[model samples]
Target: MDNDTLLMVVAQLGGGSWVWRRSGGPGSSFVRHQALGSGHLRRPHAVASARLGGHLYLGVADSSKGGTSTVFRWGSGGFYPHQTLRAWQRDTHLEFLELGGRPALVLCSAARRPLVYRWSGGGFAPHTDIPHVPDVYAAKHFRLRGSVFLCLTRFLGDAKVMRWEGSMFREVQQVPARGSMVFQPLLLAGHRYVLLGNDFAPSRVFRLGAGGRLEPAQELPAPTPRAFVPLAVGHRHFLVATSFKGATQIYAHVTEDIGT
Candidate 1:
C-alpha cells in the first residue's frame, strides 16, 4: 500500500486468497482484482513483498496443498504467479530482507528449522537453515554496526537473537519469553529496543544495555499482544501495539530528565 496505489492482499486459512485494489482517491472503496481470485491460493498463512532487479515480487506461504510457498510477480495489471518454493512445509511466517547485499527471504516453520533463501539472479534458492530452531512462529531481522541479526520468536521456552557470523548465524543472546509470538526490534529516538509480545505474560520492552545485552525497560498490560510498530509524526513519537484479545493500544514515547 502506498500514496498512489493501494492494494490489500489477504491470506485465508480455509478460503482461498484474493487481492483488492483501490480505484479512486481518499474515501474510495476497494474492489477485488480480476487477475487474482479467491481460488488462486489454498490455506495461505503468510505473505511478504520484496523488490529485486527492478521487479516487485510477492511471496505467499501455504500448506494445505503441500507446496510451501509461491512467489508472484507484479505487472501493470496485477500480481501473477511466478514461482513456487517447495522446500519447507507448514510455514508460520514469511519475511523478506536483504542479506549480504542480496535479496533474501526467511521462512519460519512450526515443524522444522527456519530456512533462508537468496535470490539467484533468476529465482530464489535455498541458502541456509537456522540450526536448532524449531517451532518458530516468526523471525525479525535487523542490522547493527554493519552486521545482521535475527530475532527468532517462539511460543514456548526462550527466544534467541542470532548474529550473522560470515558463514551462518549464531546465538548472541537469549531471552526467556514463553508464549511469545513476536520479538520485534525497533530503533526509536536513536536507541535500540526490542519488544516481546506474549500471550501468557505481560509484554516487555528491552533496551540495548551495556555490552550489547538487552535489559528490561518497561512492561505493558496488553494481553495477547501480537506485534509492535513505531509511529512518528513531526516530533512526537508513539508505539502502536496490536493484540489478539485486548484492544489496540498506542503509547507515547516521552523523555524525562534526571539531572544530578
Candidate 2:
C-alpha cells in the first residue's frame, strides 16, 4: 500500500505466514500480497501494525513454546526484520501504544506477565511489566475523563482495570469474570461503556456509572462470545458480537425518553 489505501494483514496460526490484501477500490482489487514469514516462525498468533517516526512497524506474535516473536519495519523494498523478543511462551497479543510522547509496545503471553517495551531511538527496549497479570489474553488502553486506563482480560481470573498514575498503572477496579477474553471500551450516546465477552458465561455490556465505576447494563445471549466491536456508519452506532459456537450478531443503538 502507498499509504493512501487500507491494507489488512492476517497471520495464520498453523502456517506461520502472513497474508495481506489491499482494499478494493475503483481500479484496485482485493488481491493478496506475497506471504511474509521466515522458516523459523511458527504458530503465528497475532499481528499489530503501527506507524512510528514515519515508518510502518509490524509486530507479530509467534506462539510456539520456545520461539521468538518479531517486529518488522517497512522500508523501500519491503518489510524487514527489525527486532526480536526471545523466549516467550504462547504469546497471544501484540499492541502498540504511544505513552508520554514515547512509542511503546505491549506484548501479552499466556504463561508470563505482560511486558511493555519503549522505543529508544535504536530499538525497542524493555520498559516495565504489569504486576500480577498472568494468563493475560488481551489488553486494551483507553482514555476516560482526561485519564488513561488499561484493561486486562484474563482467561483464568477476574479482569482488571488499571489507571495511569503519572508513573505507572495501578489497579483501580476488578470485574468478576471467568474465561474472560475480550474487554472493549466504547462511547455510546455520550456515555462510556465496555463490552465484556467471556467463554464460559454470557457476555455483558457495562456502563460507567457514578464514582467512576462500571455497572452492568445488559447481558448478551450468545454463549462463548469472543469479541465485541463497535462500528459507526454515518451518524449511527452499532455493535457486532462474534461467538465461538454461535452465529455473529449485530445490534443497533436505540434510545427512548421516559417521562419524568
Best by lDDT: 1
TM-score of each: 0.91, 0.91
- Residue 184 displacement in candidate 2 (angstroms): 1.4
lDDT of 2 by residue, 45-90 (tens): 7788888888888888878887788898887646678888856578
For 20-74, candidate 1 gives per-residue lDDT tens digits of 8888998999998754534446667778888789887888877553555788988
Off by over 4 Å in 1: 1-3, 34-40, 63-67, 209-212
Each candidate's lDDT (Cα)?
0.81, 0.78
lDDT of 2 at 36: 66
